[model samples]
Target: MLLEFVVEVPAEQVRSEVEKAYTVLQRTARVRGYRPGKAPRNILSHLYGGRVHADVAQRLVDATLNKALAEQSVQPLSQPAIAPAELRPDASFSYKARFEVRPEISGVKWEGFEVKRPSVKASDEMVDAEIAGLRRKHATLQSPDPERPAKVGDVATITFKLEIGGEFLDQKEQEVETELGSGHLFKEIDEALIGMNAGEHKDVRLTFPAQHQNPELRSKEGVFHVTLKDLRERIYPEVDDEFAKDCGEESLEALRASQRAKVEKELTQKASDAVAEQLVMEICKANPIPVPPSLVDQQAQLAERELLAAARRQGQRLDSNADLRARVRLDSEMKVRAGLLMAEIAKEKEVKVTEADIEKGYEELAEQSGKNVAKVKAEYRDPKKRELLIGMILEDKILDMIEAAAKITDAA
Candidate 1:
């Protein structure tokens, strides 16, 4: 874990640094009966004692550490721990730095791996389902008769208040519009809404699922006081050429073709991802590379931040749950290991990311996000972010190479 580096600058360089430090002190340090920038070196040293030497030593260590690491091609995961050393006026400066370097992964077997490639053809049934979904999206909502009760496939507008443990929950009385039996609400609540007429009130009790996203509400029982305010039926458009035209297609055939193409593309991407994931799993199992604790910890922190951001986006509060943190940490460790192995493979294969690759990456991002290239570039203004993007591009290229060299078999 400790990567040691030794750097010795010539006496001439040490003398130059000492003189520079003295010049700076003379301009900034005040002494008795001496004007600024006019103080002698001895006089400044007398006033400042070892301060000048300490400053010069620090500067020399910083400069030498960078230069030595570059020359030796050594990259550390953290700041180097420099051993304490004295700076003498007439001697060469020498210092030792100890730090943690990324673990070296050898004997990576990324080629000739056998993987199953799933067939990803789109079917007519899939196209029909997609078109049906489009028709439902364009459906019209009409108010049901006042005497009619809410039923499945009808949109119900309701105002509900929740009571947890017999205490009314604050800010729980809210109105929502949902289709009956749509699973948007709890199944019990959705069922209870059926056969309820407008202005009718009922109470539904339910227990939250164990795997609910909200940790506090998971497996908890609560009572909902519901009032059905209105009911509306959805009238879906007919699936024909007119509907296809409404969907920006010339004819029904064109619409189905477009949907089929979209489905095929999605399935192909999904299959590729599955193959890639399996390949990575196989590589990791074959080559058990030791991951650096620092890298794992860094990745874990990043994962935690992303999780918190996602929770905030959904307007949910996530408490400091130890179980969630542990799960995320474990996932992060695995990801870090996979990433290290991939990088090692990339290095061995001389897989490099060119300027054109980065530009293409940015373009793809912009296209997917519906943003301008300039906007996407501005978002990656941070140096670390830019470096991460380039690294990702390189990793992807390496993955492509691996897939090409892999022995693929059709999945049964």
Candidate 2:
């Protein structure tokens, strides 16, 4: 929705600006054969007339365009492109600026969209599994009973010396504690460790491919002399009163009730989120409106940054992937379009982000980040970050309104 925004400054205002610009320039501008503030108007015009006119024209445009836009209630998506217009004495000044504005949205079919709500409940088995997982997560390593052989699921501490291609890779044995079946050790070595008793030594062969990631191991045949120093088993605790107390619960019954409630709440939130997402997609499809290229570009940049950060975390590079970047740009365009639709929907429903919502948002951020409320507030003190937070709050409010107006069906 690019429109030409034209504004005409009266001749009197243009003359006033011209005089003001010259007055300021005359006070400080240096010229031959004349002291500052003592040069004649004609001389000053001859020396600095071009710069002064540009300055005055820019000043008049800046002073009047904002006022005109405010009076017309035109909100541009980004900065405007204004062609430089000449200013003449005893004549009016006018300039036309072009920029993207929100397209007029009409006939938006946004009500009573169909969505499916997943009906989820925590069963006894689910609760038991969850408690069992908790116990395993808190499990400890214990020495195996009867001094048996090392097997999968057991932690093995071993020392091994490697010789590759008729050369010793390590002058001394390397000691490492690795869990069997966890891929921490080489596949062949892990397989060789099974059914091995403590203090037993074995010799194994290994081959490295040319395309291997490590340069030292590439295209090499190797041998490993392994010694199993010890074997330990992972022991999970029993679900009793003592376990419940350790988990900050009064008893086993209380722990079960708490886990059931937590699981139920999680299911409810998931269903709500799914429904909202479906409704938003439907509404966006119903009303396809033109979105500004600048907004879409901003979204694409944000997506690219997020992708780069994720790649860095996994020790990978994504900058050279043109296809992925192109796909990201395509996805970002749709996100921008959907976001514009949601904002319009929010305006239509009179959905507002209140002070209470902001306070609640701050509190939730603090809880999620394990930081205090004051620190979270301080971190968002920058105007841009605070505005981003408010935008998120507004988005949530709009989604809630959409979900409330949707026709949701319960599903198993």
Candidate 3:
């Protein structure tokens, strides 16, 4: 952890060095009370002498520190605190810095590890369930069982108002009908509405969970006045071969086969991704390196910004009152860990993204983004940007290489 840098001032150059700095300040200095390059050197010196002296000292220190660090082979993890001794008007300023250095790591192994890959294939039943979900999405509502109270899987119509401290935060309305469990409405209102005969009214007090997304609403106790207006449950008819034909399938078996095939394709991609992640983690575990906390913090900040932008795009407002710093800190740590782990794996495996690999990645991204491949390539034309994309591709290739070496078994 020992890092030392020397400050140098040549014996023959002290007077010239101070004069050079003074000359530059005279030419470049801009004072509010005087025109640029027109102010008297003595007047400027008198007006901003302390500030100019500090600035010049810092510049000289930065230049000397860089040279000293190079000569001593020392690297600092943080900015060095500068505390230079007072310099006489005729003497050159000089100072030295000593600080802790990041620990050096060597002789780490980062290859030849195995991981169990989870197997997932869409079954005939799964496909049928998905189709049923799609049908529900397209289903029309109809009044049924008017005599029964609301129950599970039944939609309830009720009028409710949110209150805080016995005063309503929501608009004051005698009746505002809304479906329970829809949007941000309480689930208990649905419970109370269900199985209740029409015209039945009740007031339910519910406590919001501490982890609620809205900081203002979190841990708040509010009473809801609800009146049961109506209740209805979804009714799904039998799905058989005839239903499959109506759904544009030759037969129920064909529909199930198609659904299973689709699921298998999706699962294959997912499993591949999971396998790559496991391999990277294994490699990183074997090859330990001290990643910079600053880099991790930067990654986390970028992620948080992206998340906020996405929320805005989706018409969701992020609460300024929420403790996002804690969330960002956790996210940044994870990202840093993953990055370090993958870097180790890439190093060990000699994994690389070839020109063709980058092209293929661009093609895939273009397809997903519904943009022309040429346009996508044009936007990422910079060599530095392309290298970053190549790194991601190389990481994936390394994961695939590890996955190929592993003995994968289908999970039940």
Report the number of the highest-lDDT candidate. 1
Task: Give candidate 3 misplaced runs (Cα > 4 Å).
Answer: 1-47, 61-108, 145-147, 170-184, 197-200, 209-220, 229-232, 245-248, 300-352, 369-375, 378-387, 405-412
User: What is the Cα-based TM-score of model 1?
Assistant: 0.74
lDDT of 3 by residue, 113-208 (tens): 667657776775778777887567645555565466656555666666667898887786455445445543567665666567767888888998
Instruction: Show model 1 residue runs off by greater than 4 Å.
Output: 2-73, 79-98, 145-147, 162-173, 186-188, 205-223, 307-327
Model 2 is weakest, by summed lDDT over 10 consecutive residues, at 315-324
- Which residue pairs show collisions in model 3? 149-195, 150-194, 150-195
Worst 10 residues of 1 by lDDT: 312-321
Clash statistics: count for each candidate: 0, 0, 3
Per-residue lDDT for 18 in model 2?
A: 89
Cand. 3 Cα-lDDT: 0.69
Compared with the true structure, model 3 gives a TM-score of 0.72
After TM-score superposition, the amount by which residue 343's alpha carbon in candidate 3 deviates from its true location, in angstroms, is 4.1
* Ten-residue stretch with the least lDDT total in model 3: 176-185
Order the candidates by TM-score, highest first. Answer: 1, 3, 2
* lDDT at 9, model 1: 79
lDDT tens string, model 1, 310-329?
98898665654888889988
> Per-model C-alpha lDDT, please?
0.86, 0.86, 0.69
